[model samples]
Target chain A: MIEGAVWRKWVFFYIPLAAFVFLLLFPFYWMIITAVRPDAELYRPWNAPNYAPFWTANPTLEHIRYLLEETLFSTWMLNTMIIALVSTLISLVCGVFAGYALARLNFPFAGGLGTGIFVTYLVPQTLLFIPLSDIVRNFRLGDTPWALILTYPTFLIPFCTWLMMGYFKAIPKELEECARIDGASRFKAMLYIILPIAVPGILSAGIFAFTLSWNEFIYALVFLSSPEQKTVPVGVTSELIRGDVFFWGPLMAGALLGSIPVALVYSFFVEHYVAGLTGSVKG
Target chain B: MAQVVIRNLNKKFDEVHAVKDVNLDIRDKEFMVFVGPSGCGKTTTLRMIAGLESVTSGQILIGERVVNDLPPMDRDIAMVFQNYALYPHMSVYDNMAFGLKMRKFDREEIRRRVHEAADILGIRDYLHRKPRQLSGGQRQRVALGRAIVRHPQVFLFDEPLSNLDAKLRVQMRVELKKLHERLGTTAVYVTHDQVEAMTLGDRVVVMRDGVVQQVGEPLELYNRPANLFVAGFLGSPAMNFSRVRVAAANGGLRIENEGLRLAVPPPLAGRVGRYVGRELTFGIRPEDLRIATEADPRDLSFEAVVEVVERLGSETLLDLSVGADTMVAAVEPDAPARVRGRLRLAVNPERMHFFDPATETAV
Candidate 1:
């Protein structure tokens, strides 16, 4: 608590908190306002006397309608959704098994293998997309949803594996041992006992993988071609802007709609996500 | 018929030899306890019996079959960890029923066994609660219920009650003893608390480092400790030791140091005959010493100056300086003792212990 004076509390606590909140939310607020603003008002000069940039007297649904009907925005939505869900499922299944093996099994070079997986996650996507695009071409997966669905796990699996490994390590080893002694085989013990306790860790990993693939740009832009095969991020940018002209209203509308599903996913699992990250086991 | 026999059991963790060659025959339905300090191999031995730790070179016989190569699941045993190891995600009923469920018991039988075990542990009211929702003592009971519901051949407990508070530990200790008596299952319990070992075990095994020092009934080990380490480790305010040279006097042997002279008791005279004129250790318990009265024999009495007085309601402890050595005496609480005062203390001849200083073994 800021002590002694009311003004001190305002200066040290309230003002800084307010500034951070404003800085974080201002872009979303601008997106919402611009999505509803008229084109005439959006294109007006900054020094124009009658310019009212922050608010619109007549809010419109024209941009949303145009985004839905005039372009392949709906197709991109379906494409991104299918790609993100399938890759997240594939990555999660691989990560759960790999993480469990790394955390519990005592094979030789286990520590080195874990470090190698982490190193793969650390490789920048900008450079990795070069070789990955070649693989995509060789597999004859270009201009298709299968291209992004199969390639996204290259990065997502490593990421999910490391996250799940740390979470699995936090659980007590005795839980599995006790289960084994209770007459369950080693595999059954892990499936029934260890995996149930690891629900939060699995959920957090799934959410993170889903968001990463949903918002990915470099690989999605490179491997996928044709307007119909694009995802939200690439589709919004490439289609909304014409040569030397930006469709400010419709572009903001696309941005607003594009972020809603990811936002909803985060808000729904926020409690479990925090618990998973902190790695607290009650017993 | 569940007799656990360990023959030449040993364990080595890379460069560290954790449990040396050990052999034990735990009788059917016996509550056997292993007591020692940290890293003393007590827990390691219990884990070996539980099949959680692989033996280096040994044979373990559960009933009749050798279990050295068997995995824990096939060993027909249940273990309770120090932290309870209760499944946090499961309800108390599910936690108790889990082992039986894994063995593919029918639904009605699983429910009946879980309820029966919960009823025995007095946890029936908590049947639907999750493990995290219960208190520490309740979690401990749930862990016990989990083990008992399985009705395994052997039950292994690794310091199960050490996590509870003092009062709860005592209460749970009594409940555990009662539970053992009712179930009549062979149990191998590991603990560092000597009080728990004495109060719970039908026979106790005392270990140090990685070696088994002594295994006998509680008072038997207390009265006749195999060596100096067992003597000191088994008692509270432990047994006192004073180094003295054995001297020949009056056609018999006497052990004497700077401030005192004491004759070797009749039974131990022959044992001390060869150690005459050589230094040895004299051992006595604090409860064996008392303020000497006129009826006490002069040959068994010595002088000590009181340094501190501690009144513990039931007894008074006097920290005394006897010549160059310090000792503590537990006397009646009403004994009028004060600091800087001199008192004549009489030793019980039969209770005096003599040990060879070099070997630290009983003479």
Candidate 2:
């Protein structure tokens, strides 16, 4: 809130915030409106005597029904869910260990190695997919769920490892030392003390990995080919949109439905996510 | 219980020598305190004894067994950290039991030990609550309970009472001393406060710059300090020092400075006669000086102007200026003294200390 007159507050804070929120949310509103609006109203010309772009006079669930019945949207959802979960789990295990080692252990080249791993994440996926596709073919894993599930971790692990490394460093070193002196092996101390205190960090890392794998398109497109095995992002765009004709209602319908799971996850762990970002451990 | 022995202990971090060659034989069931300013390597030495920190060279022994190669888990020690380091997420009961659980104690024994430690700490009612829910004093009890439940051979404390308020610190300091007596564990405590060192330690080791300056009973260190640093470090307002030259005059050794002159007592005549014509640091605690009467010997008295008067209920501390030097004297609260008032103060010749100006070693 800007302190001063009401108009000053509006000019400095509230009005700009309103414009920003409207700009960010208009696309989502458009998606929902297009998904439920009747095709008759949706295709109405802009020059019509009565034209309203933001709202529809009549709304129906026909596009959702078409999305479920006519296409393999349900199968895409299932495939995406399995891939994202398995990849998140795989990344988390590897990330937690790598992050702990980089954060706690005294080893040669640890600093350089951490930076090197993060550098791999900076390489654009657009360029890496070409080589990755060749490997997927070499392993004969193309056109299967394994194609994306295993490939998703290539980017996810580095991202998760970096996030967890910073989180583990914020914790006081005395906690582990005290546990060790109390007759716990180093491994047991980490399991009982460090890992439990790091729940927020782990949860946030898991959520971020889930979202990244869920929205990932290039690797999904490059690897899977079968319609039923395809992920949500790929199947929705490639199968529904034919050569030159865009299925506006069903397209918007798929977009809106495809993003719900990520939103639900974010809201579910919103409190822990903020804690992880702030790295506040009260003692 | 076990005695800890460190021989030629040294620790080096990159280019910095954090702990130098040090040797200490901490007796079994003895409450030994290591007191020093920050970066004096007291905590580092304690950590080495606990095996949390690896020794760069030399050896550490718990009992007769050398623990130089053992990990912290095998060292049989428990530590209370400066911040308490309570496990923030667990209930007080679970935090206290974590050590027993890690050591594979039976469930019934773990509960019994936890309850006993909690009873001693007076935190039995708060055992089910989390550390964050408790107040600072309760949280401190939880930290202590966690350490006591282990029943290790030694207890290591690293400035554990420093985080508490002044009043709470004094209260906890007494509780800690009683706890040590009942537990009868050989404990190594570290603190920067001289008062804490004086009250709690059976024997205190004063360290400075990674080296031991003096180690003795608290009163011994106070009454008879080994060096300049120990003399000034162990007192409340600190021992005052003035550079003075020894002169052979009037058939006696006269200690003369910018402020005044006094004859060396016969007990130190042999030591004082050799330092004639050489400058030495003369030290006198504030409590050893008093407002002088006209009948007091002129040789032991000096005319001074009171600069500031600190009326501490039990005593009045007068900051005085003599010639070009400033000195502080603790006098009776009823003494008629005011700022800028000229007065004659008498020095206690028997209590005076002399140190070499170059080496700073007691003469």
Candidate 3:
């Protein structure tokens, strides 16, 4: 691949690839090691005689046990799951409809409206959350899962809509036209033909929306106050550390566990996600 | 079966007038083909008939009912697109049965019709396989199977065989003819291939720039094209034309150019008499020219040097230079003609065509 000599292959290709992989995986390795390290080894001084920061001589599950038993980690996991699933569903339905209309309908200003939706997705959540916090308070939804459930869709819908629109456009319009000629109405054609063809797109969008809401911190921190209502990212950080002190063991353990579901979702639908991104419909 | 009649059909896409004031009467059970170059409104007319496109101004009648306002589903018709448009996710059986299922047909009836159509198209072995699993020819058959299962009163095909390989295209064209004969359905097909138009159509409509140039039975249009476009578009080698001035010689009208001078045949002499002393286009197909023999009259013969000789197995084509004009002649393969050598060529007077240069219309 590097063209000629073995040294050239190592220098130009394999060495760079190895360095990139090491850089990417280093943080995950640190998190896993910290989550399993005993308290004695974790707090060891850097210059101490037997100190090894990268490896541990005695690995234990005490941090994970403490995270599970001492704090409301499981409650945060459940809350994140519910909020993410509901918001993703809400976003997906609206997104699929908006995407279909924008991509296929002949209405005026469809192009402008599509651009308008994409512009909404570009609005930074840091500023958007300020106004959203006001709305959440006015509706008396603070300190509850509904606050994030409703607000997540503001960004997620636009993301899903733009992605689904591109996917819907990639499918041949003749598939729908032939269906209509074959005695299916426009609605039926979309239901039986277009929707089935767009499953990969919908799955990719759903997974993305789910991951975004699951790891969201800004809105979760601003809106939810109760220990029971906080999602994983917010609760783990807020509960594990006090003003000037840090709980490294339980904090890393909570974070490591918090990311598992999202990782599983990605791995389960990786094939469809790639296919959706490439937008191929073979006939 | 039902007759499809279009009256003053037109389509406008913003500033482009895609189809203009087209009227045609397609009789019942007739395989009518709309043939033309790209953007010539042949597909547009077919789409209007299928109710896929809105008519800018006109009426489309199928079976005595005006289908101008009807959606494609309400009109009883089936279409096979050039790309096959087979549902990639559906199996052959489900794809064929989808239309029947949509119309709420009973399960048994749908199954029976799907099987029968598959049997006709010989795709019975692929009933459980998705469209992507089939070859191009097999996919084409499945597309045809999908249409026939519906048993619609009319069928519309938009260059359905153009996507196949050349050998497969010819094979499918013959099968399509046999299929139409077996079904006896009134069909409207669209294509740009002249050979496909000639071989497959009971009638052919040649169009250009969104206007119908000529429409008749295939051979009829070939023998009697109304204009220069139709004459040139319908034939493979294309009719050759040379601008020749008419002159009076010995009480008869003669046509002469830089290298050719011949008396007008008696059958066309009356039309040539008025154009004397004016320029007109002399037309002849390649097959209408041959090497001159002793029996041929000297007046109808001309001397030329062969510039190129193409030896096709069945016949040979010679590109000849006659003074300033060049012409191609399809001659017997064994004809003793050599490149750069002189040969006397004669024109078949009966097949000689003349056109008014001003209007480019056949006289």
Across A1-283, the per-residue lDDT of candidate 3 in tens digits comes to 6599899999999999999999999999999999999999988899999999999978999999999998999999999999999999999999999999999998999999999999999999999999999999999999989999999999999999999999999999999999999999999999999999999999999999999999999999999998989899999999998997788999999999999999999999999999999866997
Backbone clash pairs for candidate 2 read none
Q: Which lDDT tens digits does candidate 2 get at residues A218-272?
A: 9999898889999999999999899988899999999999999999999999999
**Which one is best on DockQ?**
3
In candidate 2, what fraction of native interface contacts survive? 0.88
Q: Which stretches of candidate 1 lie over 4 Å from their true place?
A: A1-4
How high is the CA lDDT of each candidate model?
0.92, 0.92, 0.94
Instruction: For candidate 1, write residues A1-283 as lDDT tens digits.
Output: 8897899999999999999999999999999999999888998999999889888998999999999999898898889999999999999999999999999998899899999999999999999999988989999999999999998999999989998888889889999999999988889998999999899999999999999999999998999889999999999999999987899999999999999989999999999998888866889
Docking quality band of candidate 1, CAPRI definitions: high
Runs off by more than 4 Å, candidate 2? A1-4
Candidate 3 C-alpha lDDT tens digits along B19-59: 88899999999999999999999998888888888999989
lDDT of 1 by residue, B1-363 (tens): 399999998999999988999999999999999999999999999988888888999899999989999989899999999999988889999888889989999999999999899899999999999988999999999999999999999999999999999999999999999999999999999999999999999999999989999999999989999899999998888998999999998987898998778888878899988898899899999999999998987779899999999999999999999999999999999998999999999998889988888888888
Q: Is the docking of candidate 3 incorrect, acceptable, medium or high quality?
A: high
- Which window of 10 residues has the lowest lDDT sum in candidate 2 chain B? B256-265
CA lDDT of B38 in candidate 2?
97
Error of 2 at B255 (Å): 1.1
TM-score of 3: 0.98
DockQ of each model vs. true complex: 0.88, 0.85, 0.91
What TM-score, to 2 decimal places, does chain A of model 2 have? 0.98
